[model samples]
Target: MILPIVAYGAQILRAEAKDITPDYPDLKELLESMWETMYYSQGVGIAAPQVNKPIRIFLVDTAQVFERMDDEEKEEYDDDPGIKRVFINAHVQSLDGDEWAYNEGCLSIPKIREDVLRPEEITLSYVDENFEPHTETFSGLTARVIQHEYDHIDGKLFIDYLKPLRRKLLKAKLDDISKGKVSVDYKMTFPK
Candidate 1:
């Protein structure tokens, strides 16, 4: 089932998510629905908070535009559907110092976009859906997506990266969003 995605300005999106332990049976089904909802929303990544579930879970599909690739030149890795990765109780082990800025948008934030600087590479330790532990290094867009989704577990948002002036400007719009005074068009365009 495709779960309803919580939009931007939703308080749950900004709340810290609780960690799901290794022995949970519901973890399997939740991960499955998250992947389904992500595909339905045409988003490469989805955090648990985005689905109104404040758990330390996230899904990623990074077969698209990479951070180092030119926006116009990059293409989706293949015609095949993306491989779904379920990261549970994840922790960043290490990361490269080099950073890159990318214009990122969030499902919660509607049409808002902003340049957020993030590590270009990182090593992470996480448990997969099978309860097996694994550690792997990731770079480029994959690294950014990992960090972005990881932050959700800690109650962070892409909007937190905005400069003070930018945040000030967006305050009113955010207010309207949370109050349901404004509506968001969910149509999303993904890179080919």
Candidate 2:
């Protein structure tokens, strides 16, 4: 099933998510639904909170980004092959390298994109969908995708990184999104 993504102003989107146990009910089913919803929304990453579940779970798939890149762009990220994986009960072990800017957008905040600055590499420890633990380091666009999803679980949004003046300028558009006035191809559940 493709769960309805919670919109930007939903309280759940601003709350820090909790970790889930291995015995969490219907774990496999939930992951399947999340994956379906993410692809349906044309998003490279989706956190549990985006689907209105306050749990420390998220998915990242950067293969499409790399696949769509031109030959020159591919060579630029020669070391980053991209990844498609689930991250559960994740914690950032370290954020290394310099900060870089990327135009980022969210599934919940449709039609709004901003240049967000984040670290170039991140080392994370997380469990797979099966609850097996693993620690991995990601860089380049892969790292950016992970960082974005990771922020959702931490109760942070890309817009939060914007300057105060810029945020003020976008208040109207943000309000429109909160009130379900924005147009998007995917399904969303707006705040009450």
Candidate 3:
């Protein structure tokens, strides 16, 4: 099933998500649905909060980004292109390295893209779907994707990093998203 993504102004998107155990209700089913929804929405990552579930869970598939990049473009990145993984109860322990800006967009806040600055490296701890815990560091585009989705679970949006003036400039479009006035190929639940 493809879950309807929660749009801007949705309270769930603003609320911090709680961690869940392997015993979470229908955990496998929800993961399947989230993956389906992410692909259908053409998103590289999706958080549980985006699906109206206030849980610390997200999926990242940077292979999609790498596949879309041409050879020349791909060379700019590190040797590791991307990784497909599930993060549950993820927490970023450290963020280091130089900062860089990337064009970022969100499925919940459709039709809006902004250049957001983020650290180049991240060290985090999270568990897999089966409840196996792992602490790992990520770099490059994969790190960026993980940070973006991790923000969703922490009640933060990429737009929140925009300058005050820039965010104000986007107010109208943001309002349109909350009111369900924007057009997107994927299904969304608007707050208004």
TM-score on alpha carbons, each prediction: 0.83, 0.98, 0.98
- Model 3 over residues 1-192: C-alpha lDDT tens digits? 999999999999999999998899999999999999999999999999999999999999998889889999988777357999999999999999999999999999988999999999999999999999999999899999999999999999999999999999999999989989999999999896
lDDT of 1 by residue, 93-160 (tens): 99886777988987767667889998777788888887789998777667778889988877888899
lDDT of each: 0.75, 0.93, 0.94
**lDDT order of candidates, best first?**
3, 2, 1
RMSD (CA, Å), each prediction: 5.8, 0.9, 0.9
- The parts of candidate 1 lying over 4 Å away from their true place are 64-83, 185-192
Model 1's alpha-carbon lDDT is 0.75
Clashing pairs in 3: none
Q: Which candidate, 1 or 3, has the higher TM-score? A: 3
Error of 1 at 169 (Å): 1.0
Lowest lDDT 10-residue stretch of candidate 2: 74-83
